[model samples]
Target: MKNNNNKLLNQETLCIHAGKAKGDHKGALTTPLYQTSTFVFDSAEQGAARFAGEEEGYIYTRLGNPTTRELELKVAALEKMEDAAATATGMAAVSGAVLSFVEAGDHVIVSHAIYGCSFALFSHQFKKFGIDVTFVDMANKEALTAALKPNTKLLFAETPINPNLVVLDLQMIGDFCQQHNILSVVDNTFLSPILQTPVDFGIDIIIHSATKFLNGHGDVVAGIIVSSKENIAVIKSTILKDIGGTISPHDAWLILRGLKTLSIRMERHCKSAQTVAEYLHQHPMVKEVFYPGLPSHQGHKYLNNQMRGAGGVIGFELNGDVNTGRKFINSMNLFSLAVSLGDAESLIQHPASMTHSPYTQEERLAAGISDGLIRVSIGLEHTDDIIADLAQAFAHIENVTGKA
Candidate 1:
């Protein structure tokens, strides 16, 4: 409950105690949820001072709350950033961060392999505002260099990119952005801060869908942007405030509760995902396995250099056709057939039909998202049971395809 900023604490310790302070309510161990819409000031002068930014205190929930502030502080500490801003949802964070920096006619370079909603925001929503976005294969420096325009203001990428699992070189991208005087933003939702901290690699901004690994329980939908205090102040004053993408106090409290066990959950997630990826790689029904932990993965070397773990998600293709993919997912018992990832329970989904369906077939395939591809989010369940569930699913796929 004490501020341990003076002493360096391990990540697990930071997860539990980073933003925590001794509670006023009978010495509560956990931070209490201040669920009110507005806070009262002692006097009119105090209210005026708070409104004028001359004093520091919570005025309105839309602007800030104690619970949300605590969660923001926890994330900022975990990410090793100067500060952070929490948003209503993952897309809110992504859109708010982009809008905070760029204006009409500004160009941004984005990794082609990104979450479908994120791609839509840049390619469609931003385009409507006269902003130009060029999606390039960020792994290829030449491609990234060619995609950049003189007006390019931001470079956004997702390492261990969603569904596809392509690991971008964080240091390389950071250096490129520095040389070009561009803000480097990374969506570190996949690995979380426990496994990878992009700020350590010189990334200017770190974004996350706290609904994923940060929460680790799949109970809350939230987002956060971690960056220099200056950038966060700009975002807080303009985009986050004006756009009204503020997270609710209760949701923030839930995410804060989930953060306490993030390290332990992530360890299980990484270990189980590694075992599952290896199992699928050797399975006759699986044609390809896309997980950074696998030595055969294209980005395994970069992952080794940048991240501490391969993360929980695994992308792989079935040896058979699209129907085979459907059968495999349908046959799974323990692994739920759902879209979201990074939960305590395993999840399986077909990206071509689910998360990436917004893109045309050519676009999806170009980004290495195939119809037969299945994405599995390994959970805290025993590794053997997880593998057995996958094996049973694969067997069902074989039987259904007449390949048994």
Candidate 2:
């Protein structure tokens, strides 16, 4: 099963066969989970060489593992990067990538609306370490340009941004970063490599919470950073190793299995999500729909230009208040009330009280997260059933408000 023509293989084929090699024992089709803490060297001289970086043999699981390496290779190939590094969690990938490059007194410009944890990482954690960060509306080119400073080392963005689904212009931002010599880091967790490839538009680093769509099953918690070999080497040797955020070999294996079905899964997710978003748009109780697939969405044009399909996640606002939002989420039957997205099962969550609670009310509003906002991660469920569940939830809200 040698991958002689991997470069020429289509994405679906690459997902199934890339980074996989026949086993030495029984020719196992799947990559084996080398669930061990350390690998033994043939001799002391070989061990010394491995430790000194003169040879390419795994010494310890913390530094590297066969399963994790295979997963990294698969993701790097999918993202079209030179190399990649896996981490314990998505936040680990985020923090590791940023910390690996910047030091005290450096500045970073980040999108105004990102995942709550990412916002906290920049605002609270990074600030304490003397790393200044400016949150700007990346869609506004002038604002983004104004946010740049002499010490700015990175420009961070999340397309079809979390909860709000605000898409950014990758080429525009990538060019700015290139001109300024600043690293452009994108959290491609929402779109994944199946829908959008950030590296194609000149993005320098790509990050993902393999816990989401990458794992699809919602069983494994992992993250990965993809970049050029030089950048990955620094992160692998320093940030990933010293910070102790290396992903477990077993977890890496689970993510590897998930990658095989990524293409088909994403296709289903996109199709179903479009149906759901369209249904919500015409609902009387719905205030607004924030899916990029919807022509009315502010990011729709950018999504059309940069991505292959609109993603599965959709955000909408109830025509009422926070209590109405809670009632709708609580009344959902088919859609599970959960925190995370990109699962095989439909999930609904209220970001103001859940994922984005870390942000103050004003900050949340600034990021387009309103109290009445509700986000749904459309899963592999049939489109009709998902829409019916949402319709019933809206009915529940209507009943509570005496409008039914």
Index of the highest-lDDT prediction: 2
Model 1: worst 10 consecutive residues (lDDT sum): 1-10
- Sequence-dependent TM-score of model 1: 0.98
Cα lDDT over the full model 1? 0.89
Report lDDT (Cα) of residue 340, candidate 1: 89
Q: Give per-residue lDDT, candidate 2, residue 155.
A: 86
Alpha carbon lDDT of residue 357, candidate 1?
79
Stretches > 4 Å off in candidate 2: 1-4, 22-25
The per-candidate count of clashes, in order, stands at 0, 0
Give a tens-digit lDDT track for model 1, residues 190-292: 9999999998788999999999999888888899999999999999999988889999999999999899999999998888888888888998877899999
Off-target runs (Cα >4 Å) in candidate 1 are 4-7
RMSD of 1: 1.2
